[model samples]
Target: MMITSRNTAKAALFLILTFFSAASLWLLLEAEFLAITLILIYVGAVMVLFMFVIKMLDTDQSTLRAQFTRYLPLGIFVSIIVIAQIVLVLNAGQFDIAMTGIPEKHDASYSNITAIAEQLYTLYVYPFELAAILLLIAIIAAITLVHRNESRSKKQNISEQINVQAKDRMRIVSIKPKSAKESK
Candidate 1:
């Protein structure tokens, strides 16, 4: 929905809501940490950033309409393929992979959070760090892009404004007070 949406603001809003829904699903699956992280990172930070960027940037809507028509046939084909794949997956219900041994059931003492944290920090540390790095890069790129289009001189200088004297703002000229006698 976000990808195909015509309005950028709406798309950003949709993306934020989608992330929240996915987070809710994760919470339902007992993945509390992942859910919270998704909310904080994507909803709290990234989505807001995307909205700000979209609002700041100027868009040409006419170009979009032209492109939409050009891509309609290909888009419809891809959409049908995607829908078919989703239906097939739903009809299958579950994967057919056979477990080599019976899986261990969680006991009353087992901590889901602890287990997740252990695997995430120890086993998946590199991938986790890489993702953080990627996010950092994206932020830097956004800042650079916005900054590139703005002139430094246009930025306000508080010190310069405060230090400016009356002389700099106006000139007090003593033009002999309009002589009424000279005005015939």
Candidate 2:
């Protein structure tokens, strides 16, 4: 539905539905933490961002419709290739329980979060740190882009403001008083 929807808002709504379905699947797999994270992060935060961006864009549907036919053939071709690949993989017997033994059940006291943290910190520490650094860089880039056009904006210099003197702000102008007859 997301891919087929002509309206951007409807597409976003479909995407949110897809996210909810994925969260439900995660719940079925007994990964409650992952399910909650998926909903909160993707549906709550990311989808809100997407909706805001889509609204801000105010796209013209006519232009989009005009281009749809141009890409239709390629879209169908790629989709067919993907579906064929999925079918081939499913029939390969790689996912058979006889080939890959059933996973061992953990004890009642076992914490998935703890196990995940252990693997992330120990085995995937470098990649995790790299991802964090990339996110930090992306945040910095976004801030820079937002402030790029604010050259005329007023920005207070805290040090200069703190060091400002009363003398600089006030000018003592002295005017001589003249008699009424002399002024006339």
Candidate 3:
């Protein structure tokens, strides 16, 4: 259904519906929190973001159709590579439920969020910090890439910016008051 949709809005609607279905499945599995989180994150936030991005794109159907054939070969190659990886992984028995050990049932007093937080903050602290630093570096690199040097920039000068006064931007002309008889 999503693949055949030519309209971006329709595609987004399909994606939102898919998220809703997955959330419903999570609820059926008795993970109320997971279902709610899925709905809130994907349907509420991500779907709205997708809509905003699609609207901002401001693309015409003709332009999209024109590029479709141009990238078709690359898309097909990527799809084939993805399918091959899936087949290899499936054949490797990594995802076999029978081979995997049964999960231990949690005690009624145990909180899922607390356990996750403990693992993340204690056991995985270094790795977590490394990931954070990597993300920070990525952000800085992106900023650097977008930051034009003073020579390339046409922005206003800081000196000029600070020295500006309201009087410079606005002119208040003084005029003598005229009587109604003089005006006539």
Candidate 4:
């Protein structure tokens, strides 16, 4: 029992450390775009999502039962198939394994940011703009929808809004001058 618990803790720690290490490796690869995306989208967002789900389900490593009877064989089979496929693909590919620091032209001349912008604006302008518009519309719709409640008065009348006038908020004040009283 003690050994199993220790193993569980070790496994959990290993999983967490591996997740962080993988992200760090991505950062070291000089692929800033991919690394930041992995950290921001995967590590930050998905980790939080998983934590929420774990809390919601009241599941911890200790309490969870490992039901390997039904799924173990299937999992092993699938994993082996995936590994074999990956191995075959990697080994069969004619990818250039040359460790030449960077392509001669690119290392000295390629301005990645400028090139990316040019490609994005010239090649993917319409789609990028459309996506931006869609995101904007979604954000506006979400903000509009999130505030909807009967607690707020029912639907507003556009006519009532349009009909509003200065008189509605006006106040009349008399400008009377003070008269001096005569002493008898």
Best candidate, lDDT: 2
Q: Residue 162's C-alpha lDDT in candidate 2?
A: 96
Clashes of each: 0, 0, 0, 0
- Give a tens-digit lDDT track for model 3, residues 1-184: 7778999889889989899999998666556677898999899997999999998997699999999999999999999999999999899997787888655565568665676678889999999999999999999999988894757777788999899999899999999999999999
After superposition, which runs of candidate 2 have C-alpha atoms over 4 Å from their true positions? 97-108, 145-184
Residue 142 displacement (Å), model 3: 3.4
Candidate 4, residues 116-157, lDDT tens digits: the string is 688889999999999999999999999889787758667788
User: If ranked by TM-score, best first, what sequence of candidates would result?
Assistant: 2, 3, 1, 4
Q: How close is candidate 3 to the true structure, as a TM-score?
A: 0.66
Residue 181 error, candidate 4, Å:
56
- Clash pairs for candidate 3: none
User: Which segments of model 3 are wrong by more than 4 Å?
Assistant: 20-47, 144-174, 177-184
Quote each prediction's TM-score: 0.57, 0.70, 0.66, 0.48
**Candidate 2, 107-143: lDDT as tens digits:** 6787767877899999999999999999999999999
Residues 42-84, candidate 1, lDDT per residue (tens digit)?
9999888998899898878998788888999998999999999
Each candidate: what lDDT? 0.86, 0.91, 0.86, 0.67
Worst 10 residues of 4 by lDDT: 1-10
TM-score of 4: 0.48
TM-score of 1: 0.57
Runs of candidate 4 with Cα error greater than 4 angstroms are 1-29, 60-66, 99-112, 126-184
